[model samples]
Target: MTEQHDEPRSGTSSPAAASPALARLVGMPAPDFAEHVWSRAPLLTRGSDLPRDFADLFGPDAVDELVARRALRTPFARMAKDGTTLADRTFTLGGGVGAGIGDQLSEDRVLRELAGGATLVLQALHRSWAPVQDFAAALADDLGHPVQVNAYVTPPQNQGFSDHYDVHDVFVLQVAGEKRWRIRPPVLEAPLRDQPWERHRAAVEQAAQSEPFLEETLRPGDCLYLPRGWLHSATALGGTSIHLTIGVHAWTRRHLVDAVLGRIGARLSADVEARRSLPVDPGRSSGSEVAFGEDAEVVRSLVAKALHDLSVGEVVEALRPQVRAAQRAEPLGVLDQVERATHDEQGGTTWRVRRHLAAHWEDAGDSPVLVSRVGRLEVSADDRDAVAEVLDGIRDAGDLDPRLRRRLALAGLLVPADVSGE
Candidate 1:
């Protein structure tokens, strides 16, 4: 059985200094929690680190700002009452005042829905909220996987959704008020993205009938980690409830197999024997010959050869490009970079690696290339050490090769370190 520890008794709230990446946010050593609880069991971390507070992401005022001022559209924001989703028209209207506006959130309609105990869901907060975007990017970088953020706001004594299981693991942060969570063991273990709770309603109901494995009221400053497929339901208690759910969509063995098979498919397409058409009619075949018999053997041999040709390294390398492509760079300050380029004499500027930009080194032909969110950039072997040094920590602009610094800065991989302080 996985060992469980109560609230961390003697740990510092320094995430970067902690062993695991997000440990500071959860109040535990990251490495220990990763090995003992991550994707293995549930954990409840209680703390009130003021600096790590999630007020910047969402709150009652933030909700009003998003719904009334952000000009959000359907799917981006949704309202649910008693577990059923309300229609878009229930809380949306044609953009009236703004030019080229599509759909705007109607505050009056949304308030009416909320008054009736409807839970407001702000989907994809990672895209809409800067704080959530940064939070997700940090966790994704640390975990080497993608992360999505969402917020749930439910009125007092009302439940948003019924007991259900998510296909992706989630880190639940109770941002405000309190929520009573009832959690039970998963009916299915580590279910795939396609495997939803609705398909096994009967089994879930049966499991919910049993004593919950965990039942607690999560107050502000509390956090919970629930692995994929863990059955759970929660209701706002006494006052309005607000929480942030960081969903981690972990990469699985199936993804690797698919990557390998995709390469195999390309190889099979080049084989003439595998491509040859089968007999049109088996009835016209000779005595012992059956329809598709000869072709089946040929296809089987081709598959065997393809499987033999597949290698772990090849599959991993093949998937790397896709991973790199998925990461997108944020809007760059082109004018600032241009101005900095002209003022090469200015040497006091300290440059740092851009935040949330996924970067890694890979072997290419005779040298290594730095693959970042922007694209794969080939650098000379002699400059690799310099690249490594810069990525390790903030560096003075004059300390770097002027050309290299300019290139990195223009590419959005490097930013002025002082920008954050500003």
Candidate 2:
């Protein structure tokens, strides 16, 4: 239950570190896992097996800051115990006078629930938490896919959810405490986003009873990878368990198929014959004999013809919007950015391409346009080089034409390269 209001609204100032993030994450060369383990099998890397631990990204204190200090609201924060989610009212109360809302998180109630063994879920950390946000952006770039971060805080000996499978691949980073994870292979391989584990609940329950493919206790600094559709369940051990689930929403063959078919549908919308009503059954019945044999055949033939005529360019163009929506743009700092852009003689100031801004150049006869989720900004022909250089990396603010710099800054295609968490 991700909330639209809770999505990445405020831009982050700190850009993700540009190191070989994935290589550091899995404790192996990035290519090694990409070639062998990604979407193919599970890989377990202990804390000592890696070049570093995830302390910089998130830890137990992060949870306190989010729940107690940040004034977090729901569907962003939730709790579950014994596989059942507690109601929102149990942890939320009125927003009070000037706020004029009813669903604000109640810190006291949250503490009560936590003390009673309910597992707290800090969802959408990529949007809500800074360190996780930076890390998510870095990992998304490494994986070439959309990624989301979720933190689970379970009391000792508690579990949050039942054995289930996700439609997206995930990397579980054990931040603190220990958890016993039981994993099994998919009952349905590479399940689509619409195909959840409950659809095969009977099969999943039966399979859970079988010997697990991997069963181990994950301590601090440990990590585990599971591809989409693999079944898993976890229970906290010792004192408490705090871990982050970095989920990868991978683009797959199904996306390509949808893109191709979607392009074909758009093309068919302009076809006069395709728009004509189907031949009315003489009997006006729900299912005439012709329904199965003749009428369905004609419709199928038309779609097949359109599919056969489809081009790769059409499919790619159709998929562009999805890509833009999935990939998050760099974080923006309104005050700092405006100052940099507006101030003259700001020669020493530096700024860089927005992280994951996803803006691309599009030729427009005389001028070029920067196309992205920020909407199109038609660029002046003279500033093309500066625009290109700025988007590529950190560039001197003075290097860009003042007009272009202001436009880029306002349009959210660039930001102060060194804006701190402030």
Model 1: how far residue 146 lies from native, Å: 1.1
C-alpha TM-scores of all predictions: 0.84, 0.89
lDDT of 2: 0.80
Q: Scored by Cα lDDT, where does model 1 land? A: 0.77
The candidate that wins on lDDT is 2
Clashing pairs in 1: 20-30
In model 2, pairs of residues that clash are none
Q: How many Å off is the CA of 26 in candidate 1?
A: 3.3
Off by over 4 Å in 2: 1-19, 289-301, 363-367, 381-386, 389-398, 420-422
Residue-level lDDT tens digits of model 2 in 1-422 = 00011122211122224436675557555655676668987777777766678888888889888887777888888999988999999988776788656677788888999899999998999999988888788888888889999999999999999999999999999999999999898999999999999899999999999998888888888888899999999999998899999999999999998898888888788878688886666664666665656757776888988998998887877888898999677667678777777773456566566667777788888799878877898887877777877677656655777667767777877677676531
lDDT by residue (251-351, candidate 1, tens digit) is 88878888988889888899887777766775646655566577678888899999898888779877887676655555446787677755654666667
Off by over 4 Å in 1: 1-21, 48-53, 100-102, 279-290, 330-335, 342-348, 360-371, 376-397
